[model samples]
Target: MIHPTVVSMVAAIRRRANEYMLRQLSDLGLEGLGPSHAGILGRLFQNGDMAMAEIAAAIRRDKSTVTTLVRKLEALGYVSRRKAPGDARKTLISLTPKGRALRPAYERISRELTELALEGFSSEERKALMGLLGRVRANLSLR
Candidate 1:
């Protein structure tokens, strides 16, 4: 039997993970939001209010994509955008009460994902796997 390529394996894993998260989100009554929106919301949920550019960077998305995601989040009553306190050119994105309320579900989803991904792995093995994946990511990030 032919072994699967690393890229294919990783892509498949990501697709499955995103699908699982989307299903969980739908079950929680958040029907319209996708992984991109989750990325932005997750960042704001963890870091509080952040500038648009910062959100884009943190989510590893382009500014235009982040703009669209932020708009969707705003429409869903999960986030709000305002001009930065000192910089009119910069906009800050923050979570609303509705968004904050999703924290418990998000935390549950995160824990579930972690447990699913690391199933049957010992602590040391999981750490090593993460370290190896980090190196792989770093390798691909080189210019």
Candidate 2:
């Protein structure tokens, strides 16, 4: 029997990585959030404020998923959503004071995840792996 295909291996890695992030989130008292929330939070942290469609594009998720995630974050007081001043049809999401304060913890968790995933790899190996994975991702992109 085959050990496993590349797609299966990558998927397994993602599942395990998500579990690791969830456990880290739990330890940090971020109970209601999970791995899915990280992309939204991290993007907001980097880009300041962004519209729903912008967040969806940045995170590679659909607008509906971004809407749900932003709504949950707003309900939790981690983010605030409001209509854009110039465009009534566009809504922007920004981090609240509570969300802004999560930077340190978020960085720590992200760093730990990287360390855990590449614990045995040399710097060159890590770089090569990233390049290969990036190529694979690009290959699968539809647009």
Q: Pick the candidate with the highest lDDT.
A: 2
Per-candidate Cα RMSD to the true structure, in Å, reads 1.1, 1.2
How many clashing pairs per prediction, in order? 0, 0
Question: Mind giving the per-residue lDDT tens digits that candidate 1 earns over 17-131?
Answer: 9999999888988888887677887898889999999998998999999998889889989899999888899999989999899888888998999899899999999999999
Off by over 4 Å in 1: none
> Per-residue lDDT for 12-116 in model 2, tens only?
999999999999889888889989999999999999999999999998999999899998999999999999998999999999999999999999999989999
- Give me the overall lDDT of model 2: 0.94
Residue pairs with backbone atoms closer than 3 Å in model 1 (clashes):
none
Q: In candidate 2, residue 121 scores what lDDT?
A: 100
Q: How far is 56's C-alpha from truth in model 2 (Å)?
A: 0.4
Q: Which candidate tops TM-score?
A: 2
lDDT minimum window of 10 residues, candidate 2: 134-143
**What are the Cα lDDT values of the candidates?**
0.90, 0.94
